[model samples]
Target: MSSLHTLLVIASLVIGGMAGMLYQKRRNEAENIKLNKTAEDIMSRARKEADEIVKEGKLESKDLVYKGKQELDREVKEKKKELSQQEKRLIQKEEAIDNKMSSIEKKEEQVARKNQEAEDKLKSVDKVREEAENLRNNMINEIEKIATMTREEAKQLLVSELLEDAKIEAARELREIEEQTKSEADKKARSIIATAVQRCAPEYVGEISVSVVNLPNDEMKGRIIGREGRNIRTFESVTGVDIIVDDTPEAVILSSYDPYRREIAKMTLERLITDGRIHPARIEELQDKCKQELDKHVLEVGEQTLFDLGVHGVHKEITKLIGRLKYRTSYGQNVLGHSIEVARICGTMAAELGLNEKIAKRAGLLHDIGKAIDYESEGSHTEIGLEVAKKYKEDWRVLNAIASHHGEEEFKCVESVLVQSADAISASRPGARREVLESYLKRLENLEEIANSFDGVSKCYAIQAGREVRIVVEPDKVNDERLVTLSKDISKKIEEELTYPGQIRVTVIREARSVGYAK
Candidate 1:
């Protein structure tokens, strides 16, 4: 019974354990089924949410596509509108171009027709001219036969008679015209000249190249001529001037051909006389100082001249040359003063004549620039003035005025003529220039002699202050042609033999005598 009971217990235990394991496996299967069901439900819920999200995204994509389509349609409409406008503009331009082309074609046709008509008219004119020429030749032949003289001889005889008659008639007419014009012209010219002269009257003074310095005493001369004249020699050599220590009470003369040098020497000597330092070193120092001062003064004078003339834009070099005219003289008249007078006269005349006043004044002011450099340069003042004008690149009119003022060149304009006239007036004005009385008398005598030397001149008189020579020719010896020839010869001889400022007028007078005593 104990063995059996033990066996039963073992069997019961095996069966109980098998039963427990079976129960545990069944519970595990039940839990696995619950977990799988939960998993399925969760997957179904996730799938529904995903489906809703995909639907929403599809709707949004459809809306976006619709908006994009609307925008593309609007852009297409605008493009079409722009293309239509461009086409319309192109059509209008094409139509206008075509119209212009048609108008040009019509004009060309009209011109062609007119050209053809002109050609026809020219042809008719040529035909008429041929016929007229034939008629003229026939008439000439008939006239030659009737007259019993050759055409050339007849022509010569007719021409001679016509010339004689024409000459007398022309002379009468010319005299009448001259008389008529001369009065008006003379009055106008006199008014202009008088007004110009009255307006611009410069002071008349003779400019000399010598500078006179007053000394403290005659003893100063001794000191100046120190130690065998060493001081005087040194001063002369340094200053390029002659220091004359003559017996002229209390004055010494500083002489130099160059006015600038003389001025420098004068200033140096004056400083030396004042400072009581008369030595070579002090002279050189003072000379240098005086030169600087003189340079400043020259520029100032140049500026003042331009200012007075109301002229601007002159080259500095030209202005400097103008200033140097202050020291230059022509026939004892100050060149600078004469230039200023000429400028004023030119300005006044230009105003009256309706020309550029500034340019006229500028030309007049610079007309004598060559004289300023004539000592250094080798040419007449006119030629030198031309060179200066060219160097400074002045206007062509100004250059012409300068070159022609002295008759060295041809007048290019009326302004040049005016300049010449003004120059003559200024130079020939009384008291404006001076010459030795002996020279003046010699010139007049020479003029009379020149006129007398000409053939057929019975008597000659130099009148108008030697500016004119009147000749009384014998009518028997001199015909009208011969009188003109004689006058020309006399004028030529005077030009070749005499040198006078301005020009001399040669007048030949011939009077025929038909005095039969009518008792």
Candidate 2:
């Protein structure tokens, strides 16, 4: 029984220990439950946080997608806008070009309309003119019919009479033309001659063959001879004047072509003889004295010429120069005298014709003034005279006359032409002047050249100082038709080619004389 009891106490002790351990374990388990609760709450919180994170991620994703879509839409709109603007610009450019084209087409249409209008007007006018012409012809026909028979018959009868009248009218027309031309030519010629003759007056040239050098006595001849003619030889060589020591007592002869030089030499010899000197120095002295005397005489002569000419307003220097004209000759006529005659004629003619006498007179005076110094001037006499007149304060018209007097220039004024005519008249008068042999031959040669230019012309001769050109045509070659043509042609050619005093009559003859055999 004791053993059983110990066993039961041991069991109870063991139970008590087990029960305490169980209680402790239960408490620990409750603490563990609370800890588990806390753990669960932490886990729930973590789950919620995770859920919130997912929601936040979804929201961000949605926002990003929306922003991307919006950006995509905005890009589409920008592209559309650009395209629209480009299309609009293209339309605008096309419209502008179309507008320009339309404007150009309108302008072209307007021009065409104007051209059509002008053409229509011209056609209308042409129709009116045609109608007028027709009406005129019809009127002429009706008027003829009213006179008597049929229109053609009456017109023919009237036309026959009219044709006869027209023949006479034609003849009168040509005759009237001839008369008018002649009258005009005469008037022009008269005008020219009148002007030239009025202005100039010149000294006439006289024959002076012998120039006398009077000696004081017969004893002076011995001094002049110098015992061997040495003085005479020296004098002749120095002066170019022939010293004729002759038996005619107390007088010596001076001969030379140049009359001024002869006079100078004569004066020189007279001075030497009077001075009674025989040396070369004395000869020179006498020559100088003679030259001085000649100068004075020349001036005196010029003054005298001016007085004789009735010319005034000349410079003294010019007057002195004009004095030299007394020694000058043109075609063997005294140039000074010719000038004077021309001046007088021009003056007289101008007075009669009621023209400018002063201009005429001036022109006539200076017309031949160039010849005075023409050799020294080295130009045409007309040109020289022109220059001289210009220098002498002459009128421009007078200068023109001086130049045109020789056809050196075209005559500007009537006075210029007048001067030329008077000069021609004065020169052309019988024995007015002489022509050189060479000139005569050359004139004949020119005549031949002129005649030979004509077809079938055989020969030509210039006679009476080119006053006539006789043309002989070959009878076999020149027909009557050709003869008339040749005559007209020759006359026209002569008129163009020749410069002479008077109108040259071109005589063209065509003789058809056959040389038959004697048998």
Candidate 3:
């Protein structure tokens, strides 16, 4: 009984569970059908909306195409209208050209007719002229036969007489003109030169290649000589100067060809003497210090020169070179003093002559700059000066003055002329330069020789310290006309062959005497 009950209960539970499963499956199937219907409806609506959107897009595209075509057509019509207007203008221009061509052709025909008429008139005139020329020639031949001279001979005789008369008149006029002009020119030149000299009175100190330094005692000399002369040798080698310590009481001589080197040695010796420390190392140290001091001194000197001249804008190197002139000498005259004198003279003369005084003075101050470096340079002072001026980009007028101050170049302006005259005045002043006896004698001899070399010169005398040469010419050999020419020739020969300062005045004397005895 208990097993039957248990079996029946299990069978019931199984059947009930199967029924519940079938119910759950039926509910799931109904839910799946509902989800499928809802999905199908959503897909149908989406398709309808998409179809409508595509139709709208097609319609919009067709409208845009139609509008674009219409705009294109309108543009084409406008272009056609513009082209037709241009064509009309071209047709009008062509018609106008045709009319101009017709007018030009008519004018050409008229010009051709006129040209023909002119040719005929020219031909007739030529015939008449030929006939007249023949008649004239016949008349000339008749006249020549009667006169017993050809036309050319008559012309030559007339020309000869006219030439002789002209020469006499020309000579008389030239003599009078020269006498008048020379008198005025000489007076003016004297006045200018005298004024320039009077205004500028520069003090000059003669410089030599030896510098003497006074010592406290002779013991200092021995000390300067140092052990084994090492100190002296080192100083000399460094300074490029020789120290001559002889029995000169209490003085030592620093000798060198270069004034700058001599100066350096002098300074170095003075410092070493004062410090009382004499050795190679001390000597070099003091030498370096002295060089620095000298450089400062050089720059100060340059600045002072420029300030004195009232010049500005000089290159640094040029200013240094100018200062170097302070230690330079020419013919025993201080170059700096001479240059200052020249600058003053140039300024004065320029003021008097209505020229640029500053430019004149500037050129005058720098004219001898070449002499500063002439020892190291290969050319003449003028050439070196020209190069220096060019290097510094100096004014062209200043360059001209520098180059032509020695007459090495042609004067380019009145300022150059003024600078040249100033230089001459400064260099040629009394006591400005010292010429050795030998050179002076040689120069005088050369002057006389040059004068005597020319023909018609009977005798010549170089007077006024060779500043002037008076030549006696043979009156038979040189006439009054040739006297002027002979003087010029002798002057030219002197200029070309001789080298001298200042200028040479050539005077040719031709005197004719008729000797007669009244008995």
RMSD of candidate 2 to the truth, in angstroms, is 25.4
Cα RMSD (angstroms) for every candidate in the order listed: 10.4, 25.4, 8.8
- What does candidate 2's lDDT look like per residue over 34-78, in tens digits? 999999999999999999999999999999999999999999999
Score every model by TM-score. 0.64, 0.49, 0.62
- Across residues 422-513, which tens digit of lDDT does each residue of candidate 3 receive? 87677765566766678888999999988888888899998866777999999998989999888888888888999987578798999888
lDDT of 1 by residue, 1-519 (tens): 999999999999999999999999999999999999999999999999999999999999999999999999999999999999999999999999999999999999999999999999999999999999999999999998998998999889999999999999999999999998999899988888888889987778777768899998999998888888888999999889998878799999999887767888898899999999887788789889988898888888999999989999999988888888898888778889888888999999989878899999998898898888898888788899889999989989899999888677898887788787777778776667776678888999999988888778899998756778999999988998887788889989999999987678899999997878878
Q: State which candidate, 1 or 3, has the greater TM-score.
A: 1
TM-score of 3: 0.62
Which residue pairs show backbone clashes in model 1?
none
Off by over 4 Å in 3: 1-167, 434-519
lDDT of each: 0.88, 0.77, 0.89
> Which portions of model 1 show Cα errors greater than 4 Å?
1-183, 436-446, 458-519
